[model samples]
Target: MKNLIILSIAGFLLGGCTTGTSITKEGTTNDPKWHKVETILNKDQGTFPNLQSLSEVRQGMTKDQLYSLIGRPHYDDGWRPREWNYLFHFTTPGQGENDITTCQFKVIFDHNMIASSFYWNPINPKNGVCPPNIQHKQIANKRYTLSVDALFTFDKYDIENLNTKGKEDLDSLVRELGKFKELNTIQIVGYTDRLGTQDYNEKLSYNRAQTIKQYLTLKGIPSQIINTIAKGSEDAVKECQGISEKKQLIDCLAPNRRVIVDVDGYIEGTPENNPAIK
Candidate 1:
């Protein structure tokens, strides 16, 4: 009788485990039971995605569209699968800087290869709710172009060469940066007019970019997130072909001799509510 009771208990436990997997029907990608976090092969690789981009994901979006927006899924799931899964990290509300809430996002596609449903787990009580601090926020890319002529003396590319106007312009830029929430990257690309030798132009442009990066770092921007590129005499905005006069050529190529700063990040509030937009 004791052996029979023990066998009955074991069977009951096995039955419970089997029932758990059968809670949701097979091929139902919208259900959390369809995918398990432990089954993810490349887990936790998805970091903070652009909040606006996450919000833009909608039903009927193709796999390419989804890839273009928030990037590919973290799992090694085959491309032709009916569902794709991703793990995302979101900033925890009222928590320390290092604190984050990791969530799983699943996209289910219909028979025609169109996304039909999306699910997040552990699920929120409200339908279609995302992780914390992931409201449908607006994200904007800010670009600033500063003429090298205005930033430095002729052919000089050092912090000390920054003129009064240059300092003022950069200070204003720092203020504008404060409006952003999570800054992804700040790219500073330097260019010069096509007068100097290739080597000379490359060095000059690189030094100019380095100087701008240094200035931004001194103003409290993190150095690691800033990248500097030197595109000497490449992609020239102005071409001074056939100009015989030196002054006319210089003036015409002034637009090409510039540093372009591109800032990518998300901002709080709508366009109407944000003063930066105004």
Candidate 2:
């Protein structure tokens, strides 16, 4: 049944003849001939829908499974427990004709958070399919910030000072990095809280960045593609209240002490190739 619907769509496009009638948003009558011509001339510009992926969507599929099938829903109403809406506009190719097609897919979920039913405006060719946005493949760039407290104790910049939790965090990131095809650049930037002299903080931040880079290199990340930078206390993420006591003041400025790792590379497939973060 699915194959037949796909073949029918293919044949209609190959024939260079439009078959579907276009109705207004209000479902009013329209001159089918003129509406078809207009749509053919100027189709809505949107992400291309993956018909094959959509076909996999079925009743009783869990919401997580649905998201894995379809990258992301365009619009979701928080108050609506049963409905998820996805919007798309794209140009359809048939013979040499290019027509704009716009659609809004409404997915209804049952109480168990499983997809129970769905409907699409404009009557999609593959009504039973689950469609994901067509994300073009390109170079991938990812950046993450790790708090200093998580990686090291206050004022500690040495790799030896990295705690067990910090190692675990890096291990998780390393696993994710394996998903990328070719790693281009890995930037490690360090920042510190504004508690010490400018010169001391600057040196501390630079050492911190270098320590992270060194650790990653030891873990098999190519050192040739890695770059380290020191930001010192230039950009504070949080402003601590002026406490006369120095020990308490440092704790309040903790958020500003951190390191940021930015990785740039090429992914094997589309942007959606990476699974959603758990």
Candidate 1 segments exceeding 4 Å error: 1-52, 86-105, 120-132, 198-203, 245-247, 270-278
lDDT string, candidate 2, 142-187, tens digits: 8888888898866788988989988888877788777775565688
What lDDT does model 1 reach? 0.71
Worst 10 residues of 2 by lDDT: 28-37
lDDT of 2 at 224: 57
Give each model's whole-structure lDDT: 0.71, 0.63
How many residue pairs in model 1 have overlapping backbones?
0
Q: Write the per-residue lDDT of candidate 1 for residues 1-21, one digit (tens) a residue.
A: 999999988766544322121
Please report the TM-score between candidate 2 and the true structure.
0.47
Give all TM-scores, in the order shown. Answer: 0.67, 0.47
